[model samples]
Target chain A: MALMIAVSLPLLAALLCWIRPFRAVAWGITVACLTLSFAAAVFIASRILANGIAIGIPRWFEADGLSILVILLVSFVCTLAAIFAGGYMHHGSQQTARLWWFYCNYNLLAFALIVVPAFASPNLVWVGVELITLFAILLVGFENTPTALEAAWKYAILTLMGAPISLLGFFVLYWAYHMSGGGTLETWQGLYASASTMSPNLLKFSFLLVFVGFGAKVGLAPMHTWLPDAHSQAPTPICAVLSGIKTTVPLYAILRLLSVILASPEARIGNWMVVIGLFSVGIAAFLLLQVRDYKRMFAYSTVEHMGIILTAAGFATSGGEWGAVAQLMNHSITKSLCFYTAGAVLVVLGTRQIREVRGLFRLSPFAGGALLLCSLAIAGAPPFPIFLSEFSILSAGLRSGHNAAVIVLAILIVLAFIAIFLQVNRMLFGNPEPQSTPASVPGSVRTAILIAAAPVVVLGVYIPGPVHSLMTLAAQQLGGH
Target chain B: MASAQTQLIEGLNALDAGLILLTAFAMVATRQVQGVMRFFIVQSVFLAISAFLIGFNRGSIHLLALGVITIGAKAVAIPLVLKRTLPDDLYERREINQVINIPSSLLLALLLAIAAEFLVGPLVSASTDPVVHVNLPIGLAGILIGAYSLVARREAIPQLVGILAMENGAFFAGVAIAPDLPLIAELAIAIDVILIAVVIGVLTRDITRTVGTTEAATMSELKEEPYIWR
Candidate 1:
């Protein structure tokens, strides 16, 4: 019941946003619905912690440890981003009358993100992920500028190309499941439990297709061309949602399927995952140095962080899996904060180019200070959650005897760190451009950033007991020992 | 009598598969936006026919329902949505700029079709079902060819059509391999495909209105500009 309500809240909110009478209050409606949804997600998480799983339906709607963790992260980031949008969009956008459309799409995107993790069946999950891509395409193009529309076009073509490929993959998966007698319902758990009985060849083929197809959506390298454009061009609040959870949502599906493959003894793709993961990291780290747009800089950072998480998961050890789960949570929280701060900077300065702005500290101390804090945290500097999680991942990789990957990953981490600080340092410390006065930051934007920062700041040094257990439980679901 | 009926069904499915691939090739060769859209509709018709044939052969209600949904979504609804949502100028625009010209694109598509055969050859060999053998390779070929056209064609509507063709290809394979898949999934997927059309159509209209062209290749301002660090 909680799951149903949590999922439906956004749909209801979207409906209400479209109603003529509720147009003026769309933002209010969105906030209230999303807040209630977040509470419901919390309730579901508590239930998962108390019991082993939460099942909304016998074979369809259910949440496991990994899923509930993702669900909670999606809901939390979305709620804060929704709050941020109320102010950011109002100030930054020229099309104020269409604000209701933005809220409607935002609610729908949130609903899709939450439900992808909550869905039990893989096929239904595929549909959910497609919905995420389509809705995100609309939101990304919401600005309706030439560049924004171009971004949307590139994003739509690249990501939607993956849809059919992944559909074929899911069909093959269904074939394998049925061939294995399909003794259980074709859910994630069912697939995992029966994986050993299925043909290894079929399992591996399906996994390859899904990985390549969903890889585009996750912004993995080679197919990651659309990501920065979409992230940089979209409204800043949407960027937060895009970077924070949109990418993670598809990666969650791949991981769920990865767990199933791990259950089969004959099917092995861990080394390939490590190589692909490193490739994405290497590409993003290098590109990070050349980014002209601060938003694109953070966008590239999302790719780099996604690589780190994937590489950690590829390590296929319990310790590594724990690190991956931790990094997933930390990155989602911190990246959203980074984009919010970036959005704040954009709002105050009215510029996205790095060279155009100077002395953020002089212009607006709050925006500058927040940017400094988030850049430090996002670069995995000490005493931040990202640093802790990356440390755990590296140490875990070493403990698991993946010495070569560990060394390479470590170097890439340092490179990405330098690249981020290099750009951020140029912005935060220099002299302000002449005649520039700091624009006042909106109260709602400030509130959103402060709330988002609480987790990035607190989780670094001290992870509360419940969150730690949640991470551990999620790692267990990855089928690592 | 039963064996004769089975043979007739099998032959008809093979014929449908051939027509589907031919339409995919025709889509690649077509230059006009409306022409490509027409081929996509034709390809979808063949796809639905194939589904119906398979459903009758297996007595699977799921595949039959899937056939109805396919026709309703792809043949009927998608074109209607595209026409209504998109500007008339989009349909009239011709001379789609090609990354690769027609002959070479067709050759590349043929190569992609062969590659698809090799890619799925082992898996197809593992399954003894004749329908799987026929549908799987052809379906994969449709996907690869569709993807190829997506890259080669730079116009908005053609690119969108390429994606829908790839979807038809996937469902082509799906009906054979997972005929027992729940009716609910088919309905959702069908709706999802139509939604894809509607959303992209709206986006294309916006692009044409704002940018004055639907040539995606012309929108090249967003790529990374090499910055020399100070």
Candidate 2:
């Protein structure tokens, strides 16, 4: 019941917001829906912990450790973004009607995110992911500027192209299942159970299809061209959602498919993920250097972080898998915080070009210090959750005989650290321009940022007992013992 | 679980598979966006027919539902939507700017057909229905051509059509091989694809209105450069 509510409340809210007469009414509906969705998700997680239900709705939906973790993360991120977006756009130049439309699509997008982790069928899962792409396309172009439109176009074309490929993967998998005697291999759990007997060739091909297809959404390298444009062009709160929950949901799908295919005794899925993850990280490291827009730089950082998570998951060791889950949580929180500050800075300075702005510290201590803190936090500096998660990944890689992968990851992490901080440093400490006087920052925006950033600080030193077990259970769910 | 009517089902699928493959080639051969859309509509009609025939032969209500939705959504609904999205002057100059000309693309399509044939070899032999051995390759070839057109065509309209063609191809193979796959899954996909089409149509209309052209290559300003140099 909680699972169903968690998924449907946002969808219902989308409709209510879309048709509501007054903007205030729409905002109230939106807030009500997000709060309910978050509460439902937490309740579902609690039930799973206490009673240990099998967590399925006949054949349609299922949740396990993996779904629980991602659901919590997705719900939490959307709530934060909803809270922050209200403040960020409240002061914007857009009219009330357009803002209502934005709220409608935003909730629809959240609905898609929640839908994905709950599916038991691969077809339904693919549909969920495609819905994410569709809703995200609308969100990306909400501003309707030429740049925003272009980003939307690129996002639509590139990611939609990846979908057909994923469908082919499903075709191959379904065909394989039917060929192997149908009933026992129909669902995701069934497929995993029977994976060893399935045609290895088809499984291998589907893995590639599923990987690249879902990887397009996850912002893996070569398929990541749309990430920066879409993230930078969309309104900032939407950017946080794009970089935060939108990307991670698809990665969850990829991981689900990966879990089944990895049982085939060929190490291709793990090895290929390592190679792709490393390449993404390496490429993003260099691109981070060339980025002139602060938002765009942070977008590239997403590609890098995705690579890190993918590389960790690819290791398929308990430690590595645990790290992947931890990193996923930490990155979503930390990156959203970074984007919140970046959005605030964009609001204050009236530009996203790093070269145009100067002396953020002198102009506004709160915004400047946030810029400094967020940059340091996202750069994987010590005493941040990112650092701890990354350390876990490196140690796991080393322990698993992925020596070269660990080395490559370490080098890229260092290079990325230097590249990212240099950009952050220039904007925060450069000579103050006359226009650099702080614009009035919203109280709600500041509150949202602090709420998001607090976890990065605390989780660095300690993960609460429930959350630690949650990550471990999630890791086990993906790469079962 | 083998149905007695399986042989009749197989016969119909083989004929439809060849027709589907021909439409894929026709899509590649055509230059005009309207002509491409026609090929898509024809191809989808055949897909619905294929599903209907499968449903009748097997007497499975789910397959019948799949066929109905495929026709309603993909054949009747989506093409109408696409036709409405055509910019007023675009049809007069609808010839797709070629990254690779039609002749080269045709040759490439043939090669993809051959590649798909070989690729489907292992799975085809394992299928209980021989129709799949024939149908799966046709579907894969269509997917390949659709992918090719996406890259080769310069216009936004044709690229969108190309994506549809690829989707049709995937749906073809899926129906051919796993006709028993759930109805609700196909329904969800149909609704999602429609939503996607509607959204894409809105965006394309806006692009045409704002940029004065729907050529994808020209919308290049959103990069990390200091300026777009327009």
Candidate 3:
């Protein structure tokens, strides 16, 4: 089955990465396997588009429209990330074995991300989120520096605290299902269809708990303390995944539940999301002005993007839903593309502190140029999909009569843009610090950036037919009015 | 329908829940780092016992497997890691480095238990059995107390324990409400717990070595750093 192939190939690649016999060709073999998994994911996405949801082996695997979208995005980004990994690791390749370990864990993370959406079981999905965090924590501390260790600690501790909160929600939902559904546990789709008949109080409680719990993983505000530390300290390719795709699993969990809760006449998840979404944006805006690390800036931008998607969800309009879906992909591509550039700068310059490194253009013109272009795209400039989708998001908010939210969102977006470009300009154009970063960058790194960048450029003006349908189906799955 | 077997099983369930609740109180009352670690093992034992009791009553093999894994990892393996991580010298130095006094923490734990009781009131009221009613609130209390300590305690190790306590509490609650939750889910949770403890152990060792202390506030500056962006 396509589902079986999609999930197992990554773990198999991980095994290959861990073994010594494949060390010489390990990176090549890993990328080849990931490409195959990517192929499998594309097959699944195409099937979901052509036919309908694919329920594999009952409870073990299922791919709905939304899941198909997530899987496609994750597979594409992860494959590109693996390419980035090969280049980034070789650049910093002091120990080959350690680099091999990175591949193993990277594959494991991809497997977990793949598993998350494939399952209908909330518990299995929870396991998927937990596994992603567990695997990522190791990568975050891969360098074993004090900062890396600290970041790993915070990530593990915070995820530990947050997951139990989510578990509480899962338990509450199960108990409610036990009482109401004739002792049969509900799949996510089943729960969505049966929302109206479930106990209102329990459903509401679970909604809030699930939101907060998963919100921690999604890097939503008040619980976003771990995100910047983890992202900035993590190796660049892993940072790309964390910002680009790892964060999606939690939001995906939330979005899957959102349709169910909203079907209830008294569901309050929408209003709650609006409040949290706005707060995340506002807080991230103020915090963006203070980011000194380039990767950390991108990490904070992720918080802003997630806020945008969450707020768009609250609009409860088809336009909003489509914009949310589009923005998720747009942010994934733009953000990962940006991290690739940041990784280039990090490997060459050897410091993540923005003020400490400069004149990237003097050292490596291609990387510096790519960094500038990615920044422009990420900051929501014209001709980029971010700008288009953000425009739709603002329109959706205004149409929904959320005037205050619209105004706040507009101001925050502009503020973030100003802050990001200001910092990037200083780094890009200024004099090289004496004893500066490496003069040359890797070809593979440039290739990965270009590959990621191409989609950003095209999707800005025109989306491919399949991708368009995928987003439409995803929006419809959310049941946005 | 009030068979002696039903009464005995119900009584055992109550004891299981009670032991977990008692461990929460003991966790709060003790400031000795080692004492808290010991309490966790005891709490985990009761948790496994409760899982076995429920599994025995329900005739579910999955719950029995959950019980075995719970004891193996949580009670035995996790505590071993915790004990190994803290240095012999810091045993006294790490003594109850909480932000609040012991009495206040105990009081807060009490208030948290009451809040948990109120929160679970609706679900408990809806329950068909009295033991089920008792099981949930106690689990909820265990969770709240664990969360309270993680915040109230100043040291990183206790906070780790606090997190473990929260997991135990939630697991305790899950046994009561979500017995039908697939075994894979429970196994996933167990695997995550051990992996997390190991990872955190590595981090704690490094933190203590570099910073020369394990207090969380000392390293809390990662987020709260003063803005220098002109």
Top of the candidates by DockQ: 1
Please give the lDDT score at residue B112 for candidate 2: 90
Candidate 1 per-residue lDDT, tens place, A133-223, comes to 9999989999999999999999999999999999999999999988888842458887888889999999999998899889999999989
Each prediction's DockQ against the real complex: 0.73, 0.58, 0.54
The fraction of reference A/B contacts recovered in model 1 reads 0.85
TM-score of 3: 0.94
Candidate 2 local Cα displacement, residue B185, angstroms: 0.4
lDDT (tens digit, per residue) of candidate 3 on B23-108: 99999888888888889889999999988988888888888999999999998888777668756665554576778898888888
Instruction: Provide the lDDT at B155 for model 3.
Output: 78
Clashing pairs in 1: none
Cα DockQ of the candidate 1 complex: 0.73
Q: Which stretches in model 3 have alpha-carbon errors above 4 Å?
A: A93-97, A433-438, B1-8, B56-62, B80-96, B154-156, B205-213, B227-230
* Winner by TM-score: 1
Worst 10 residues of 3 chain A by lDDT: A91-100
Candidate 2: give the clashing pairs.
none
Error of 1 at B39 (Å): 1.1
